[model samples]
Target: MLKSNIKTLIVIVGPTAIGKTALAIDIAKHYKTEIVSADSRQFFKEMEIGTAKPNAVELAAAKHHFINSHSVTQLFSTGDFEVEALKVIENIFEKHDQAVMVGGSGLYVNAVVNGLDEMPEIDLKIRAALNKQFDDEGLEIIQNQLKQHDPEYYEKVDQNNPQRMIRGLEVFLSTRKKLSSMLSSTKKQRPFNIIKIGLNTDRAKLYQSINLRVDKMMENGLLEEVKSLINYRRDNALNTVGYSELFDYLDEQVPLDVAVASIKQNTRRFAKRQLTWFRRDEDIKWFEPGKPESVINMIDQELKKP
Candidate 1:
């Protein structure tokens, strides 16, 4: 009844703190296959507690790759992940017909599953210049440039986010090609079939889970983790939500309580953005986080599709 003809990549995706890791492990174990992590934060070795990495029990549940595989010092871009993750998946299919990829990072997931556009990399000088212009002229100047250059992306991009706008401008400047036009608008066909399972909960409930998770992270010594990495605070890798907020506390710019509350609020915002990104993928099938059995059943059905 099953095709038995193609390998399958079972992608477990959801907002942060929504239990993707546990579900991915359970599913990987069921298939007796390995897991490839797409969570960008979890890739670095120095960041453990703040990133909410899998506990020893959860990790020993199944084999995983890309966890603690890089250092904050490394400039591991999404392009790097696409190449490495595909290799990992190829090795997985050598031993099993299925493998699980799990993460809250939408861009990294998209990079592996859909493939990034083959755009030329911009020089660091260009990026630094753009950043300086952004700081000096404010976003309106850069926004106007993007509007002039890549009006299509300008319309779709989040206008409030300078990073997105600057990236758009960077591509336009680097190649004179619209970042929108260079996107992998046509999804790349892979050798394997992909089955995407999205886990979501009531929005309010999701926010509450994030808040609680942050509290647990603090209890687990997120502040101490930031303290250890204080020297590397200038690194772009360390400029993330949890660590950055705690870094602010360390800098004496904000009190500890304020930093904790800010982490919860910023994490909720990040989760909302994650949901927005994953929701755009029409291929993903959604389920309540409580009903992982339903997800398993869906995967069973998909694996049998011809």
Candidate 2:
């Protein structure tokens, strides 16, 4: 069923540096619509270079929301994004027939489009305790405990994400309720029709593109970007792919070359995970990245189909 009589949202999503931004700008221009970003990392003003925020020309071209619009110190989450993005969309729909939501973060996109399950408010004490356990006992120990307690969530979650693991264990530890149980709740209906467009390519070619993007980022002064944000290293924004590996280098845990290679490897892994998450949605209309005309025509066809 159509969720709205007036509003439509075109969401452009894919892995990082797969040309999502360029395509989003083009679509936004085509529709004369504004764009809302679902990328969690790009929200921070201090994270310009590492996040690959749109350059000035692209930013001026598209009416973009949530790009470098928040401070790193502010606590934001998918829930916050859902609230803000919906409000933004409500306003945009006042002046246009469609709006665009674009980013690579799967959870953020799901929150905006499919809606997130309502979980309990986080208990700081429990979170602190879990973090201490992670620090003292190491991540593997926590991961193992989670696997034993909530195997379903362990399977669906990104195992490398310590924050998510900690939150899962926090809920299980506090209420003895499985995190997966909360996640299994029914989806909430939104007031706009949602159209999902997924970008993909041959696995080998995508991985090669990811590797090259990492190399270009390093050559373009990603190190300097991380260095500038050294004071904010403890911020959640720094807990991302490129910056995290650079942190390991700064800590002397590995050589610079190894860190760069690890960034490329981890980014490719992230892209793989993104594909895995997005592929689960049967509603997504997949397209190759280079075929803008085909994608635009496909969207037009879908929208026009009564």
Candidate 3:
């Protein structure tokens, strides 16, 4: 590749609780560039403590996009993210030769680095009806509906999350096709060069990090934040690990201690899933989170690749 034509998107990816935010800041500061967060959960303005969003200091350390950029009440999908992120990258590239994208959300990263297939627009009434059914009946009804409609997606989706179940059911209903099918069509090529860096550690260490992070989130008033968002619990953005567990406790479905334990355990599980998804991307060079300089050097080398 010619040096004059270099426009790189350095994608930092890894499991939750693996210190991705700090590493991304370091790299962006080194490159004198900005950051685009691909963590789907952090996109909502109403979510903070539960999404493990970057602290005030971190946000100030580097210019960031997509954090607190949307309302939890709004419908923001992966396809939407691809569109917005491309626009962000285009504007960023107009000034800098490189930009950093960091998050544990593999699909969101893929959407930006690759692209998204065309997803059919579901009728508003369909989602409205599904929401009503989920409210009146229960997640079980929606769960069964998804299983019956798109068994493939239902098998992989978080069955406890009504948002995922409803999404799968609505896609199937709207296009008469499986959401999984739509996602697996093909990867779209992007104009700029992409270099992916993955951070990970031993399982025990990763789990330890997850546990400690959950404990820290609890100490940081995660319970209170969840309680405050109780009215938005049914919103798609709140149907995630940390917030969902606390919401369960708020509803008397579990004790506080049990809910805390659930948050830690579910976070570990989520980290494991994130690693599995990222492992499939052979382009992502793995690195220890502590070795930022090495990771940066690797990016420098990859960008220099002929």
- TM-score of each predicted structure versus truth: 0.88, 0.93, 0.90
Off by over 4 Å in 3: 1-4, 120-129, 144-160, 173-176
On lDDT, who's better, 2 or 3? Answer: 3
Candidates by TM-score, descending order: 2, 3, 1
lDDT of 2 by residue, 1-306 (tens): 344355789998887778899889989998899999999889999988777889999999989999988998998877899999999999999999899999988878988887888787767898898898877876788789899899867755556667767778888988888987886378888777888999998889898988888888888999999988889876666777898889889889999999999888878887877877788888888888877888789778767756
Off by over 4 Å in 1: 1-4, 121-125, 131-166, 173-181
Query: Model 2: runs farther than 4 Å from truth?
Result: 1-4, 121-124, 137-140, 151-161
CA RMSD of each candidate after superposition: 3.4, 2.0, 2.4
Query: 5, model 3: CA deviation in Å?
Result: 1.3
Better of 2 and 3 by TM-score: 2
Collision pairs in model 1: none
Q: lDDT of each model, Cα atoms only?
A: 0.86, 0.84, 0.86
lDDT of 1 by residue, 1-306 (tens): 234698999999989999899899889888999999999889999999998999899889999999999998888887899999999999999999999999988778988999998777897788899999976876689889999999877755445456678889999998888897876677887888888989999999999999999999989889999999998876557767898778889889999999999989878887877887788888899988866678888899888777
- The TM-score of candidate 3 is 0.90
Which model scores highest in TM-score? 2
Error of 1 at 21 (Å): 0.6
Residue 237, model 2: lDDT of 63
